[model samples]
Target: MSFKNDALAYHSEGRPGKIEVTLSKPCHTQQDLSYAYTPGVAEPCREIAKDPAAAAAYTAKSNLVAVITDGTAVLGLGNIGPLASKPVMEGKGVLFKRFADVDVFDLELATTDADAFIRTVEALEPTFGGINLEDIAAPDCFYIENELKKRLNIPVFHDDQHGTAVISGAALLNACEIQGKSVSDIQVVFSGAGSAAVSCARHYIRLGVTPENILMCDSKGLIYKGRADISGTYKEEFAQSTQARSLADALQGADLFAGLSTGGIVSGDMVRTMNERPIIFAMANPDPEITYEEACAAAPDCIMATGRSDYPNQVNNVLGFPFIFRGALDVGASAINEEMKVAATMALADLAKTGDVPEMVLNAYGCSSMKFGRDYIIPKPLDPRVLVEESYYVARAAVDSGVATRTIDDWDAYRRSLEDLAEGIQ
Candidate 1:
């Protein structure tokens, strides 16, 4: 059967969709039903009414995240609308459960208006521990996320923006070490100026890349100072004073090229124009700006990565979000702040350097060995260590940053619990 047919059959065979609500507690007996629905439920409701924070203890709100989307930007499909994006949102729920044991309720909103989306999500804070905004378009995504984060007490994360940023930031840390370059000194150029690109540019700066040394470009050439085209957009923050007006122009002597735009836009010649040992993350999905084969043919010394799993150093967001959220939710974090993000990145980078890839992970990828190098710059998504290590670091950071309401009394016990959780899933 064709791949397309197999996918459709898989989703349709057992259930109508990818996800369903399963009972974590028993309700088989008539007495259990009363406890689950009416009289017994009223006790917890009164407790929560007296103290709103009691909801976490009495209900599943602490472990529940809403994977909500406006569906204006569904993967490489683009603007498929809410109903069409259900499958993708449900897939996200599957990952959240399979990876971190987190519960997700996928919510697809039919409206695109930023204010309406924010208002709806804000009103849902009582039902969810976190809000995962997905697949919304760029500028509105920026606005919606900012407004929701400000209005809601729980962690509100846009996986499209920060997930890629965190994962790629980890890869960048390892790549710089192997290439014998300094993070503060490297000249980084971006191929897209959308949410992911803007977020990555900011994240790289936080990771030590100089803001002035970075150049960002959109569909209409480079974003330079005094450019009227990007006056009121998120791209304005990246606009710099430069003579470079095109991607090719920006690539000359550049140490890194981070592509988040459409595929087939970057060529081999453009790769060659970059500095020796240049790190090229041509991460446009389905197809990259430049293929791994073409990039190697152009610059044999360069470290190449893409969004595709067929290539090495794939910057998959699955490596970041699940574990990051697990930590945030465990700590009862008020927000997914910058410190927690950096902690996750650092954990991933450190994991790659351990040179102790688990046997199961190696077998899953059909490889005998994997280590930190030009090829394996980030941990594979299947590696069980990510759940324990990354989540620990993020949780620790949340406590140290003073954003966590609940604190872990014993660090060793917390880590062991995470390991147990990982083992249960495996």
Candidate 2:
């Protein structure tokens, strides 16, 4: 059968969905049922009621994350509604389990209203260790995450924004290193002005990319200071006081080009105008701003990456979120802060620089060679080192940044803990 039919059959054939709940403890006998429901369960319940933090110990809340979404922006599918978005959310839960052994309960909210969405998620704080905001549209997504983060003590992450930022930031660091270009010195042009674009600019700024050196372009020409239609907090934040009116104008002499916009928006002519060894991340999913073939033909000197796996350097978000949340949840972190994200990004960059590709990773990608160069600027998603190293760095950052409620005094033991988690042990 074809892919579409196969996917429909896979989800509908057996369980009717991708995820289900299984008993952690058996309840086959009368004694087990009494302990599970009436008396023994009440003991943990009363303990949790006496001390709220006891919930983390007596319940499954510590390792649980809610993959919450309103389905406003269902990736390439685009606003397919909550029911249609369930499969994707379940897929995300699968990644969380497969990568970090973190438990997930995928929650798809039917309301598209930002206030309703925020309130719904806030009410769910008791059930999950963290809230992962997914596939919500741009401005609303921003509003929801900000309000939720302030209202709830748990980590609130809009994966659409920060996930891309973290993974792309890692790729950007490696690309800059290979090209011998300093972050502060480079003129970066972004070909989109939505959540990912604005968030990336903010993240790059935190990573040492100069704000004034960056230019963001939307459907309208450049997001310049005097643009009439400019609105929203993030758009205003990235607005530049520049004379460059178009993407092509901004690309001239630019050292980096980041495309989070629609596919095929960038032409070969635009790539030709960039500075020597320019880094281009044409990260539109299923397609890119410029095709890999066209980009090579345009500027052979350019180091390029895309969102497609078929390409050499694919900037995938799977390289992030799972490990990030793993570290955050493991440390009992109050929030996923900038320091933690930077640690993850730098860890990724450092890992790639080591040029140590595991045989399993190579076999997974079906590649004979994987080294630190133009072709391999970031680590593969299946690399087990990401769980140990990235989560280790993130957990350490959380502790140092004062966001962690729990402490890890033994570094060696902490590494072992992460190793155990990666091995699917609690």
Candidate 3:
């Protein structure tokens, strides 16, 4: 069957959707029903009323995330709107549950008005422990996340903005190691200045990349100083005072080319102009700025990755989000701070270098031999070790960074708990 038919059938089969709400507690007897609803529920509600923080202890709020979207930019299908984006949202929830065992409520907002969307999500703060903002278009997404982070005590994460940043950042760290290059000295060129692009650029900076050495290009051209169309705070932040006016000009001798733009935009010739042993992450989904074959044919020595499973090095965000939130929510983190993000990235990069690919992961990828090198810069999505490594480091960072409300006193037991969670997922 075709993919479209398969997808439709898969979603329509059995329960008619990808997810369902099932009670965690038993309700077999009449007494159980009464305790589950009226008397027992009321006691927890009364306790939560007396102390707001008790809600985390008595309810599902501690482990719940809201996968929210206005659907202005649903994956590669841009501006599909909210009602049409339910499947995507539900699928996101599935990832959250399947990967980290975290419960999710997929929330698709009906309106695109940023103010209305922000207010609506803000009101939902009491219901969820964290917010996973998905598929909202840029600039507005930046604004909404910033405002929500300030107003809401719970962690607010824009997966489009930070998920790509964390995953790609990990890959870049490993690639730089293989190439014997320093992020501080490398000249980086970005193909798109959207939410992911700008966020990744900033993330790179946090990971020791020099700001002035980076060049970001939007649809118009290279984002340079004095550009009339520079719209938002993030655009202005990356705007460079340089002689280069286009991607081609900026890419000459560049150490990295991060493509968060459209497919097939970077030709083989463009790849050939980069520095020796260049790192090219052509990460546009479904397709890329340059195909793996095309990039390899051009710059034979270049380390490459794309947002594709078929590719050798796939920059999948699945490696980051579920675990990041898992760590945050476990520790009752107020926000996913920069330290926590960097910790997760470093954990992923470190995990790859350990050369301890689980047999299950190897089998899932249909590979007999895989290790930290040019093609295997990041862990596979099914690598259950990620649940332990990424989440552990992120939670520890939250504690050290003063964002966590709860702390893990016994490191060994905490690791065991994470391992159990991973085993359950597997």
What's each prediction's TM-score?
A: 0.99, 0.97, 0.98
Q: Order the candidates by lDDT, highest first — what do you get?
A: 1, 3, 2
C-alpha RMSD in Å of predicted model 3 compared with the true structure? 1.1
Can you write out model 1's per-residue Cα lDDT over 1-426, one digit (the tens) per residue?
999999999999977998888898998999999999988899999999999888889999999999999999999999999999999999999999999999999999999899999999999999999999999998899999999988999999999999999999999999999999999999999999999999999999999999999999999999999999889777888999999999999999999999999999989998888999999999999999999999999999999999999889999999988999999999999999999999999999999998689999999999999977989999999999999999999999999999998999999999999999998998
lDDT of 2 by residue, 1-426 (tens): 999999889989977887778788899999999989997899999998898888878888889999999988988889899999999999999888888888899989989889999988888899999999899998899889999989998899989999999989999999998999998899999999888888899999999998899999999889988777886456877788888999999999999999998999889998999998989999998889999999988989889999998988889888999999999988888899999999999999899988578888888999887989999899888888889999999999999999998888898999997787666632
Per-candidate clashes, comma-separated: 0, 0, 0
Estimate the Cα RMSD of every predicted model relative to the unseen true structure: 0.9, 1.5, 1.1
On TM-score, the stronger of 1 and 2 is: 1
Span of ten consecutive residues with least summed lDDT in model 3: 227-236
| Candidate 3 wrongly placed segments (more than 4 Å) | 231-233
Give the TM-score (vs. native) of candidate 2: 0.97
What overall lDDT goes with each candidate model?
A: 0.95, 0.90, 0.93
Q: Arrange candidates by TM-score, highest first: which order?
A: 1, 3, 2
TM-score of 1: 0.99
lDDT of 3: 0.93
